[model samples]
Target: MMGNKILRKIVATVKSESKGINYFSHQSTAADSYVYSILVDETSDISSCEQVSICIRYCNSQFQSQEDFVGFYATSKTDSFTLYNLVKDSLLRLGLSIDKLRGQGYDGGANVAGKISGLQKRLSDDYPRALYFHCAGHNLNLVVQDACQMSPVIGDAMSCLNKVVVYIRDSPKRWDSFNTLLASHEEVSGCNIRPLCATRWVLKLQSVDAFLHTYEVILDFMQTAHSEKSNSASMRSTAFSLLRKLEDFTLYFSLRLLQVLFKAVDPVHRNIQSKTITIGEVLTQVSSLANFLASNASFIASNAKNDDSVAHFTSCKEFASKLHLNFACVPRGVRVSAEDYFCGLYTGLFQTASESILIRFQAKSLQMAENLRRVLEDESIEDGIIKTVSEFYDDWNYIDILRERRQWFNICRHEGLQPSINSLRTQFKSELTYKLLLPNIRSALTLYIVIPATTCEAERSFSALRRLKTYLRSTQTQVRLNNLALMHIHRDDFIKKVDLDDAMNEFIDRTTTRRNKFGIGNK
Candidate 1:
């Protein structure tokens, strides 16, 4: 029963390895060429312990962008004052200079993103160049969440789907039963079930799509559970209620509509997660998606039957033609015609998504980032725009700014070279104002490149958080947990480079008995 004396040493060695690998990644920020951005988000552990994740995005010596999980801070208070101080101390510990921070991104929590006293406001006060923007990915999720709020049917359907998936997955017998059905049912033989994510709604697309394909099988399973006479009365009642909700036509249509709608927003949502995606690019992609939804809304509106004359019912007719659908009651307590209700719902979804996107993206924080985009992609050079760009980086010397502007116009002449911020950084080595002499231009470009567009990577670290700090490992110390999380999030960046044999030997002398056998300090 290796009661784990040796296992403890292995864990200790892994913790040391995590620390060494993370410190190595931290050295990238020590570069004279590095200007980094901060991404901070607070999440609780399984034990409900609140901690903040601090990630820094910067371009490495290779000029490739990196968003590295740098540290975690545990604190009792999450107020902006406490959080701001915690962030400062964390950076100081890592030996990263506050002067090098060029941007800051976080979700729209009032304590974090508020203009007056929020963390962003505090950060921008001291580090003016650390411009703030609402995280683009969270903004997209908010768009989906806002649209979901508009339709009660969507809310109800989400509840039903989420509960049913959890109900089955909670019990091993139920999960195994569901798996057996998936294997046997021909309509969705190989399909899997995914629970709807509670935090980010855009991620719910996969969960919704999975259940849609497996809907029939789930229905069959529920039907058997409800009808089985030997089942407990409470169990049968619960199963019956869930089954009725599943069988509702409104819920089914909501699921179907959400499938298509989520698919519509998927591309923009996905593109926003990129490290190099600027606010301008995200706005462009969002505008395109909004236009697509608008077109679909128009099609749906004109095709559905209305109170006037005869209508085509093109979309509704097409969808309902294949399967039987019931005319369900709306919130007003009257059963409406299938042609009108579903079409209106479909059009409403498109309208909701488009409107929410347009409204939410018009934030004041994005104005500066948009200005940077104009300088990069816009052919017509405007002095006013140049002033805005230079003012954003007001820390730069005036002479350098003047020269960079000349180099900038010259670079703009080669229209073909204007693609992405990253590509431009690469192209600059040879042609940035006559042999890359523009140091300010290079640094400015690096600054904008490192300014993270979204906090998606920080959110990704939360998944690792759950994996590393499960209930069984709940007793792990905070330092140990942080080390393990940094290693887990950044394993690919440094795992292959770790010298495991040396790491083991370094941690081999933990216990006195083991040290005696190893002859440590015997000489």
Candidate 2:
């Protein structure tokens, strides 16, 4: 502060001594040309307490603010006071205001609090109008996790599959040999080899297929195993069974259900632009998907109820019926009015029926008596039952349309449909439900497709963090890091202060050149 005061006095004295130049005036005027807007988000590794955060700020002009390293601090013992003050100080120095904040985004997890807690809530307490959204893509992924956990068989199969994948992947020679074997089977060499990854679903499907194709080779390699030396007969049998179950799961995914879900969720992704998707549309898509899943779930549940001899399973018929009714409750047309029964006018139409409908979900019986009969009756390819059922399972696109012949094959194999026995019936119900509910879902999807609600926005925000926060690697404090991270993330909105020195230099050069020309009588 004292140095700045002394500098100001010196500059003023110099200006007073000058006769023609108004350097300060030129500097002040040039500082007001353009505005830079900034947005911000922060990431921290809480485990190690080796805390670091990034702040990115970008101007409306060419200089986009980014940082690779913004702040670093030991989190093991730091209090919130130090953290909060650090951020405040950094922003103040950068000439950013809490008021200038346009938007905020985060991956709503325990580490990063939601609207109710953490940075967003704190910022909201300060700047009320700051637009905040949870990343939509992240939400979608969570939804997938929820859906998967609902079935234990699927959970186990996935676990076993992961184990096999890890074993093979750990050995390069085994993994390569496995691929080589697959290459020899078909014209396409090793085109089918895919590594199993935990979170990636699409890639996992190809990996499952690769594993199944090279099962024999894998077993042979495993015979000389070291890590899983306890590969007993039962373990081998379970692995093979799990492999088939995975195949079934993959087959089920190939159905249009997952595709439809993707389509439904595509809109409402986080990044806000001019385009916007409406709530009405999102609701419609949800209703359609719900109706479809409910029907299938209902059918499976109902079938399980009929087979009282089987273990625990709840019938979802009531929920399916209720959701089906929900579809009817949706209002159609572009200008949907509340008064319109199909739109929202007849909101009360579903009220009466909604109360009575019950919600039930059940696991279907995989085994059937009739499926056993077909396998015993015929062993040759000429026999219709075995041939038909084998063909059905082999076709990836067949979905769940199982003919009676396939049921006969299951009976012969004595394989109680290891997973969902009511698949065909469930499919029937789902297809019917899909047909009934598609119009509404489609309309809603079309409406919301223009707006992204998924966490793709969160991914984008993190991408910026990795780019900025580069310079302040070691000395960067956690609070400064957090503030800087948020600032640079939203830097696009921050009005960057013009560099007065550069502006003054340009101004002096132009002014001097003009004066010289005028003196030469060239004005």
Candidate 3:
């Protein structure tokens, strides 16, 4: 009971500190109170109750980057305007002004991203400085989704993979049988498989990797289950159906193609997902992925030359993926040759992926970011670039920014430093000269760094909520859950410095009855 009391006190401190009184920049001080950005994402908890999680990304007084969870607000209405009001109220509660917001980050969902009626559009009406950039991580996820949906064969392959995974894993006896078969096979790497996911990497690439590894083991498992007379008719029927689906050369090829595509896409996705990476680094990753897609399309086009024996090898029969036994490239009874059908698929896949990335990443956002890179580049900035950047900022004048942008570029060139956001951020913090010399440029640099690359912090908050709030604890108040979530999600920031006794005393002082009982007076 004492341990529980102590634990509660400690977490309560997490909630108190996370209200962020110390982290808050007083609006009165220009230097300490920096312009910040927000990352927003929504999820339904176990009870199917919808809630929005808000996190702020900004540079601290020490000029170090911070992405901290503010709070979660449950809402029945989720349209652009209502969601904005919820966000506005949440920000008001946190003592942050909407006018000071410099950037907005969210997924590609229409509710948030729609230019006409979306939350981004509504927020811009209120504060023009809050430029919305689609989350870079979600952009990559959408790219993969677009590529998969472009082809019907690939879609069916994905569905087949999901069905097989669910069917075998749903029954304990079947799961045990599958693992036993894996144990007997010395060649299998013992990697596990899972369902494919749209929003996360969890159900995606690694699952494809494991499935590719245990191809023959799976075939044997399916064949044995179907052939056994003692097995349930449903099990036999399912096994037999999936066995045929697996033997379809098109399905096999499509899955392999997906594995390779995701392999290329995952690295870029990982780069965007990393909190340490700046938007500048993320933009570089975007360019790199584009180049890979271009080259991969060429590689796929060149695969048109493989003949029957080369594609369907009988010698290496143990490895089923490598040795193709069936070559029916039929879709809905429409027969097509493997060479013609697969060649189109392999080439068209990356072509669609490249197009999706280009469309989804948005030229306007890229141009906005690239214009700032001019401050770190060798090029001479003219009046037009200054006007565009200043217009986005909406701070009344483009004249002062022109001078700062020029001087900032000169400083970078004079120092012979690489032109990156991280490099500029380090110099700005370490050298007091830069801050005093170019205040406008400093503000721009600070705001640029605060602009979020991803909403992964908000997603992480949801994950912490899943652990802290379970089915049995469904009756707990949302405010209490929010407080606990603040402690659990941002525990690393609080673990070492926070004192439990101080937190409990503080909590007691805030309450009228507790203060009277403890005989503590307000300072």
Candidate 4:
């Protein structure tokens, strides 16, 4: 009991600024903590290749208020499951649910997978039409990865180059020397020796000819390094590997490759600011790109073969099988059924696979469904449970105005029904409406949007963690570290009543004071 009290107090203080919660402990793994799940719908645009995921809870159409966070549990042991449970529990503690969910986006890892048991499957089972979308950017990556692999030499080159980067970056002195040599090059070497970022390399592949012009400068730098230490076989190997890799890179980046890259970047540019994109948009874009690529492959390949230095472009015969696999996974371009989509979205987003299990809880003594069934069949389903479900189904269908043409609802003032309709609208706007609609809409939106999406939105805590654990300072206990991380999440909530900027500034100042007092940066 004493330990428990102390632990609680420590967590409270950590949360004051760190704004995160730790769930790896034995306590968090309990059944109670795993009760709810979080869902997120994600979309990746093929044109620009940016992915966005949205977290939400179900409520009536009129419900439009936003919650700071929502909480739920994932039904599995994967990253998506862990992320969903943590985010959902945290948000629920603050009074949010799936009713507020709007969209979801992801790049489709096992944790973020949109398939069944994948985040999408889980979310759709709970929330209907929560819009499980594949990331277009990821599909493009697959295309590029396949294209690169088609030429074994290119694949080897990329692998070799990646290793070279890792080796140099790992050795600070070597990396610094490499940078210095580039900066000191007397002619046309004024360009900064930029850090080898992954995305930039992909872009470089589109213009291999431009890079080939500067290959000599890199070789000169390698030669100079080798001359400085004649006994360094390691240095010679690195230089030779880098040259070989560049050759393969240049060979692979012909006009065909450039066009394919352009297709992927276009969609990413369109939705850089959006928090989430729908599945329909992603499927449509990918399908179009695949069709175009398939049709133009022969022309592109013919041009590649004519280039004297092209050496090896991915052949049409070799690429067709991979393209077919990608095409098979691409969602059909036809309009998906709104009702079916919504049902799957909610179920996958909100409800855990094990949700229907009662565990130790007994069945309700009061019978409600049978009584409501009569009213549902005969008289109009008014503003009760049946009415809540009815409104939820219709509201969900209308939420994604992008799916179909938007149509306005017409409430004919049929005397008594007018008052009821108005009352329903008013009730729909309430928080209670979200709670009531949970049962019906849970399957459609919960699994995909709620369960896979996370509330680990502590932008402040990440900053704090970086400050605490820098490249120079990297020793800490796992327990203390967990406590510290949790503090980051709580800190966001703690300062909700205070000015966020002021709190962050104060926290920074405190860290600066500690650094100065400890003489931490006095090199």
lDDT of 1 by residue, 11-95 (tens): 2322222111112133422233346778999899888889798877766544455667765677889999999999899876666
| RMSD versus native structure for model 3 | 5.5
Ordered from best to worst TM-score, the candidate numbers read: 3, 1, 4, 2
Shift in Å, residue 290, candidate 4? 5.5
lDDT of 1: 0.71
Overall lDDT per candidate, in order of appearance: 0.71, 0.36, 0.72, 0.37
lDDT-superior candidate, 2 or 3: 3
CA deviation > 4 Å runs, candidate 4: 1-88, 99-106, 111-116, 136-139, 164-177, 184-190, 193-213, 226-231, 241-273, 276-392, 396-523
* Candidate 2 global lDDT: 0.36
233-291 per-residue lDDT for model 2 (tens digits): 66556555544433342222222123333333334222221113222233334345445
Q: Cα deviation in Å at residue 150, candidate 4?
A: 3.2
Q: Rank the candidates by lDDT, best first.
A: 3, 1, 4, 2
Better of 2 and 3 by TM-score: 3
